[model samples]
Target: MVGRFTRGLRVVDDSVDVFRDNPRLAILPLLSLLSIGGAFAIVLGTALRYGAVSSVLTSDLLQYAAIFVAIAVSSSVGTFFNAAVVHCAFQYFDGKETSVRGGLAAAWQVRRKIALWSVTAATLGTVLYIIDENFGALGSLARVLFDLAWGLLTFFVIPVLVLEDTKGLRPLLQESGTAFRETWGESITASLGISFVFFPVGVIGLSVLGWAYLFASGVPALLIGSAGFIVLVAAMVAAQVLGMVARTALYRYAVADEKVGPCAGRNPETIFPSD
Candidate 1:
C-alpha cells in the first residue's frame, strides 16, 4: 500500500510537470466552468424572472425537460473542454508545444461527436436524477452505484473521442471501457496519488480558516477566511487539471503504447505500482 501511494505521488508529479510545461491546459477547465456557470445563471435568472420554474416543476415532462437542459448544458461544456485538454496533452506527447487556441481548434473539429455524446450523457443523467430524487434511500443507493459505473466506463471517453476514429455512442463507450480496463490498476493509483498530494493543501486551507475564526475577528477574520477559501478553490482546480493530465498520460500508454513527457522511459509498474 505504501509503495502504491509513493508511486501515485510520482504520477501526480508527472502530471504537475505536464501542467508546468503547458499551463494553458488549465484554461480549458476554467473556460468550461465559466461557460457552464454563466449558462446556468442566465437560465435560472430568466426562468425565475418569468415565473416558469414552478410550472416546469409541476409538470412531469417539463420537469424532465428542465433537468435534461441543465445536464446537457453542463455536460456539453465540460466534455468539450475536456477534449480540448486531452488534445493539448497529446500535442505535448507528440513533442509539440500546446496552446489554448490549438486545443480549442482540435475540439471544434469534433463538434458533432461532442453534441451526440452530450445528448446521450444528458439523457442518462436526467434519468438518474429522477430516480435519485423520487425513489428514497434505495433509489439514491442505486443512483450512486450507477454513477460509479458510468464514471469508470467513460473514464477514457474524452481521449478516445479526441484521438480515435471510433464513431457512434456505443463504439465510443466500448473503446473507452477497453482502454480503462487496460490500465485499471494504474488509473486507480493515479487518482489516489493525486489526492495524496492535494489533500494536504486542502487541509492547510481549512486550518487557516479555523485559525482565522478562533484567533481573529471582524474584517481581519473575513480577509483571512477569504484567503483560505481562495487557496482551497485553487487547490481544487489544480487537482482537477492534474487528474486530466494523468488520465491523458495513462491513455497514451494504454492505447497508443507510447509514453512521453515525464512519463517517458518510466516503468508502468514503478509509476503506478499495485497495492
Candidate 2:
C-alpha cells in the first residue's frame, strides 16, 4: 500500500486531471435533483411528525436532538446515494457500462467503508462543534485549524472508498494522502472555478427573487416564489453535477499518476491497459 503522505501529494496534482476530464458532468444534475428532493422530503417529514421546527425555534433541547438525528440520518442516505452516482460516473469514465443498478451494486459492495467514513466525518464534525461551543478562544482557533486540515486531507476519501473499494482507515488515509499531495492545488483551483461560475449567478438570482418577494403579495408572491424556487433548485442541481464531474476527472488523474491499486474488480489492464 502507498503511504498516506505520498498519496496525499498525488491527489493534489491529480485534481487538475479530474477537472479537465469532466467525466461525470452529464449525470450530475439528475443525481443532485434526486438527492436534494429525497433529503428535503425526509427532513420535512421528520419536522412535521415531531414538530421539530417549532420546538427547536422555541429552544427545546429534546426537540433539537430529535431534529438533529433526523437530519443526520436523512443526510447520510442522501450522501450514500450521491456516492453511488459518483462511483457509477467513474465506471462510465473508465469505459465500463454503468447503469443505476450497477452503481447501486457497486455502492453496496463498499457500503461498510462508506458508512465508516461518514460516521468518522460526523464524529469529527461533532467534536469540532463541541470544542467551539465549550472551549476558550484558543480552542476555537484550534477547531478551525482542525476543520481546514481535514477538509483538504479528506477530499479524496469518497472516491477512494467507492471507486477503489478500499476499506479501513489505512486505505482511506493512504488514498487521501496521495490525492492531496498530487492534486490539492488543482482540486482547489477547480473548486474555485466552479464556485466563481455558480456563486455569482446564485447571488444575482437570489437578490432579484428577494426584491420581487418583498414587492409582491398573495397570488403574485406564490407565482414569483414558485418560479424563483424552481430556478434556484435547477441551478443547485447543475452546480452539484458539475462538482461531481470535476471530482471524477480528478480521481482518474490521481489513479493514473500515482498508479495506485486497480479499481474495485477486474484486471488493471482492463481499465488502463498500458499500466
Candidate 3:
C-alpha cells in the first residue's frame, strides 16, 4: 500500500509537467466554474422572481424534479468542460499543438453523448440525494459507499466519451469501468494522493485566516483573509487541472499502452511498481 501511494504521488507530481507545457488547460475548469455558477444564478433569480421555490417545496414530486433539474444542468456543464480538458490532454500527449478552442471543438463534436451521459449521472445522483435525505443513518452510509463506487467507475468515462467511439451511455460506463479495473490501484491512489496534498494546503490557508481574525482587526484582518481565500481558491483550481492531466496521463499509459510526451522515459512499473 505504501509503495502504491508513492507511485501515485509521483504520477500526480509528474502531471505538473503537462500543466507547465499547457498552462492554459487550467482555463477549461475556470470556464466550467463560470458556466455552472451563472446557470445557478439564473435559476435562483428566476425562482425568486416567480416564487417557484415555495411551490416546489409544497410537493414532493416538484421538489425532486427541481433537484433533478439542478443536478442535470450542473452535471451537463461540468462534464462538457471535463471532456474538453481530456481532449486537450490527449492532444498534448500526442505531441500535437492544442488550444482551448480545439478542446472545445472536440467536446462539441461529442455533445450529444456528453448530454446523455450527464443526464444518466444526474438521475443517479438525484436518487442518491433522495435516499440520503429520506433515510436515516444507514441511508447516509449507503449513499457514501455508492457514491465512492460510482466515482471510481466513472473516472474514465469522460475520456472514453471524448476520445473513443463508444456508442451509448451504457457502453460508455462499461468501457470506463473496464479501463478503471485495468489500472485500478494506481489510478485510485493518484486520486487519493491529490486529495491528501490539497486538503492540508486548504486547511493551512483557513488556519492562517483564523489566526488573522484573532490577532488582527479592521483592514489588516480583511487583507489577510482575502489573500488567503484567493490563494486557497487558486490552489483548488490548480488541483483540479492537475487531476485531469494526471488522469489523461494514466489513461494513456494504462489503457492506450502508449507512453509518449509527458509519460515518456518512465517505466510502466513506475506507476504500478508493485505489479
Candidate 4:
C-alpha cells in the first residue's frame, strides 16, 4: 500500500487538476437520468401503494416502513451502478477503452462492497431522519452534522473502490480517509459544483410544471404532469452521470499527479511523470 500521509497530501493538491480537466462532468446528467428512472420507479410505486403521497408528514407505521425499505433498496442499486459508471470513466481517462456495459459489469463485480456502503449510508440517513422526527430539540443541526461527517468520511470511498480494486469495510474506510485528507477541499468543491448545477434545473423544471398544471385539466394535466416527471427524472440521472464523470476525471488527475501514490505507469503518465 502507498504511504497514507503522502497520499493524503497529494490527493488534496491534485484535486484541482481533476476539477480543471473535468470534461466528463458534461455527460453526467444524461447518465443520471437513466439510473434515476429505474430507482425512482420502485420508490414511487411503493409510495403510491402506501398512500405516502397523501400525507408523507403523517404516514402510518407501515407506510413509513415500506417507504424506508423501498428507498434503501433503490438507493443501493443506484449507488452501485453509479460507482461502476465512475469506474468506467476512470478507465477511459486512463486510455483504456470502456463502455457502459463494462462499467455495469464492474459494478456487479463489486456488488458486496457497494451494497455495504449503500446500506451504511442509508442507515445513517434513516437514523438522522428518525431522530429529527422524534426530537425537536435536535433539529436540523443534528442532520447537518450527520451529513457532514458522513460526506467527509466517505468522500473517497467510490474512488478507492474503483481505482485500487479493493473491497471490504476496512479498505473502504482507510482509503476514504486517505483520499479525504489528501483532497478534501477539492472533493467538496466538485461535489458542490455538481449539486449547484443540478438544483436550478430541477427547480425550474418543477416550477414550469406547476404552472402548466394550473392551466390544464384532466388528461391534459395528467399528460403535463407525466412529462414534467419524466423531465425531472431525466435531469436527475444526467446530474448523477455528470457528477461521476467529473469525479472520475478528478481522481485520475490526482493519481497521475502522484498526489495519491506513484504514477502506477498508467496512461500519458507512463511516458512522463507529473511535476
TM-score of 3: 0.89
The sequence of per-residue lDDT tens digits that candidate 2 reaches over residues 34-133 is 7656777887798789876776667645544544554455446655666766776676566666666666676678777767776666666666666776
lDDT of 1 at 36: 88
| Tens digits of per-residue lDDT for model 4, 122-196 | 676677777777778675688888788877787667777666767678878887777666555455555565566
lDDT of 3 by residue, 77-166 (tens): 888888888888888887799899999999999999988987897799889988998998988999999999999899988888888899
By TM-score, the best candidate is: 3
Q: What tens-digit string does per-residue lDDT give for candidate 1 at 1-275?
A: 89888878888887888888887777788888789889999999999999998999799889899989988998889889988888888888888888899999999999899999999998999999889989999899999999999999999988888999987999999988998888888888888888988888988898898899899999999999999977776776688788878888888888777776546789675666544
TM-score of each: 0.88, 0.71, 0.89, 0.69
Note the Cα lDDT for every prediction shown: 0.86, 0.61, 0.82, 0.61
Worst 10 residues of 4 by lDDT: 259-268
lDDT of 2 at 271: 32
Model 2 spans > 4 angstroms off: 1-71, 258-275
Position 113, candidate 4: lDDT: 77
Per-model clash counts, in order, read: 0, 24, 0, 15
Model 4 stretches with alpha carbons more than 4 Å out? 1-64, 218-231, 254-275
TM-score of 1: 0.88
Total backbone clashes of candidate 3, pairs 3 or more residues apart or in separate chains: 0
TM-score of 2: 0.71
Query: Looking at candidate 2, what is the lDDT of residue 140?
Result: 96
Q: Which wins on lDDT, candidate 1 or candidate 3?
A: 1
Candidate 1 displacement at residue 220 in angstroms: 4.5
